[model samples]
Target: MKLKNLRYSCRHCNTEVGSIPFASAEEVIRELQRAEEGNGEHFLEYDDNGSMTVRCICEQCEQSLRMNPDYYALRKWIQ
Candidate 1:
């Protein structure tokens, strides 16, 4: 099996944010374990092709969110 990493992008601005590689099943399990231990704010998705995607906010969006907290309630700001 080949490992694949799908980078996350800002849902509003389409900026690349972060990535996680599923090099092995164990690695995927480890990530899940870590997520379960935390508050589980991060977004994760799995595709039928075996790729994993981790959604996160970019620095610019972070600043925008800090400046305008109301954007957090919108589903999409740029579209």
Candidate 2:
């Protein structure tokens, strides 16, 4: 069986932030189920190839957002 990997990327800049690996597909499913039960906000996406992607802000974009809180209202920064 192929191992499932969780990839994290910046939502605005599209920078690859981090990744988590699962020993098996079952492990990945369990984690996803747990996440669904939790109340915290999480960005989860399933790709056509069966990989998972999580959208999050990187350090640089986080700093930018802190400087300009208005950017949070926009889905993505055009510049």
Candidate 3:
């Protein structure tokens, strides 16, 4: 059986962070199933090869957001 790969990337800059190898996606799938409608969709993406990509903020963006608290008010602050 093909193992599932979990990839992490920065949501703002779209930079790939890292990845984890998983023998099965059962646990991950279960947790995702319990997430609220839009919540899961916003952070998770599935690949045709059965891998999953999670979108999260990176350290640089996090620092930027911390420095510019007002950026939080905008929908897209990176641009």
Candidate 4:
């Protein structure tokens, strides 16, 4: 099997945010590898650049990002 670079979708919000900034497919994979088979609590999205937009979301995260636009960093999920 190949350790392919994967695009991750936000578990909370359906947005396009990848993981180039986080670096390494392994780095992203490690975060949610233990949740379950095919159930990644976190994810990485992709842009036209082939870069990724990483996202990890629980119910709290969804509510936090949605309720407070002030959390500009969280805008990643809202997208």
Candidates' TM-scores?
A: 0.60, 0.70, 0.74, 0.32
Cα deviation in Å at residue 65, candidate 4? 6.8
Pairs of residues clashing in candidate 1: none
Predicted candidate 4 versus true structure: per-residue lDDT over 1-79, tens digit per residue: 2334556445656554443333466665555454334654234344565444445555666678678867756434444
- Greater-lDDT candidate between 2 and 3: 3
Prediction 4 TM-score vs. true: 0.32
1 or 2: which has the higher lDDT?
2
**Which scores greater on lDDT, model 2 or model 4?**
2
RMSD of 2: 3.5
Error of 4 at 5 (Å): 1.3
Local accuracy by lDDT, each model = 0.65, 0.72, 0.78, 0.51
Q: How many clashes show up per model?
A: 0, 0, 0, 8
Q: Who wins the TM-score comparison?
A: 3
Error of 2 at 38 (Å): 6.9
- Among all windows of 10 consecutive residues in model 4, the one with the lowest summed lDDT is 14-23
| Sort order, TM-score high to low | 3, 2, 1, 4
Clash count in backbone of candidate 1: 0
